[model samples]
Target: MRQNPERRTALTDAAIEVLAEQGARGLTFRAVDQRAGVPTGTASNYFPNRDALLTQAGRRVFERLDPGPEAVGEALALPRTRASVDRLMHEMVDRITAFPSGHLAMLELRLESTRRPELRAVLTEQIRANLQENIDFHLASGLPGDAETVVHLYLALSWLIVERLTLPDLFDADRTADLITTLVARLIP
Candidate 1:
């Protein structure tokens, strides 16, 4: 059957929603079909296997979370100063908060990856690509860190963002802002 891009996107999106709401175990083709409100076998038509479906769902989350050129330009075009660092930090937090479900789905995928090495490898590649893209963006945007330092900073900020969003009661917005500000100060030189 000829692949329909729109339909594939729909299936992947549904998969993300299922993964977010129900975690990895609930991410069945039927569940995705139900979530998508499509006919039975619809998800299977797009993804022949569990691995394919899971991988596509992961990719879809990244696609949805990707900041387009305008946001990138706005962040990058700022003067490389302490205030610019603050704006960039705010941007990162805003983005992570904006897509809570996607981030949660990513966390689910991380846990699921541990049980399935194939899933682990797939996620590893995706994460590596994402990290490299961030590092590249950092270099282009003139963030103050070497490549290794930037990677570490990304990892740290990722954990903080995940924690802050997934457990809002644990850290109020002001505290989260304070944490981000301090981290940005240290990480951006």
Candidate 2:
């Protein structure tokens, strides 16, 4: 594998784009190199095989989707109310949608993981950790929700995101935002 961290990240990111656009079958080293605009075989240097590339791409999508400290701080600052939860959910939707490729690649990875047990394990671990983090944040933030509430919100909002990303025309922007508010109101106490 190559020792250049930046190049490796770039290749992984490119792989994400390839996965998003072409699905797992279309993800090839040459395609990744072209997407990254690097010389041919560059991705192969960084990833020994397709599975390694796919695994790294899965990790990279989460890294790219991380909302960072600023967003977390902003969430914590909000009042602990159902309306606040609504606002937080709206912000979450906006944040996830902003990186369309990352979310779309995540969907692809979820599908691919079904065929590859190793990939399935990696995604399962990462997703479970992320879910736990969300649950912990909701509890610690004093948000108007328990762990179950958080889990329901997570499931609902995730499907909403899938709808928004895969079939955006199904719901317009205002309608989608309205749906988030409704979800928070109904799910939170």
Measured on C-alpha atoms, candidate 1 has an lDDT of 0.83
Note the Cα lDDT for every prediction shown: 0.83, 0.93
Which prediction has the highest TM-score against the true structure? 2
Residue pairs of candidate 1 with colliding backbone atoms: none
TM-score (all chains, Cα) for each model: 0.92, 0.98
lDDT of 2 by residue, 35-102 (tens): 99999999999998999999999999889889899999998999989988998889889989999999
Supply the TM-score for candidate 2: 0.98
As a whole number from 0 to 100, the lDDT of residue 33 in candidate 1 is 94
Runs in model 2 lying further than 4 Å from the true structure: none
Q: Which ten residues in a row have the lowest lDDT in candidate 1?
A: 80-89
Candidate 1 residue spans exceeding 4 A from truth: none
Quote the positional error of residue 188 for candidate 2 in Å. 0.7
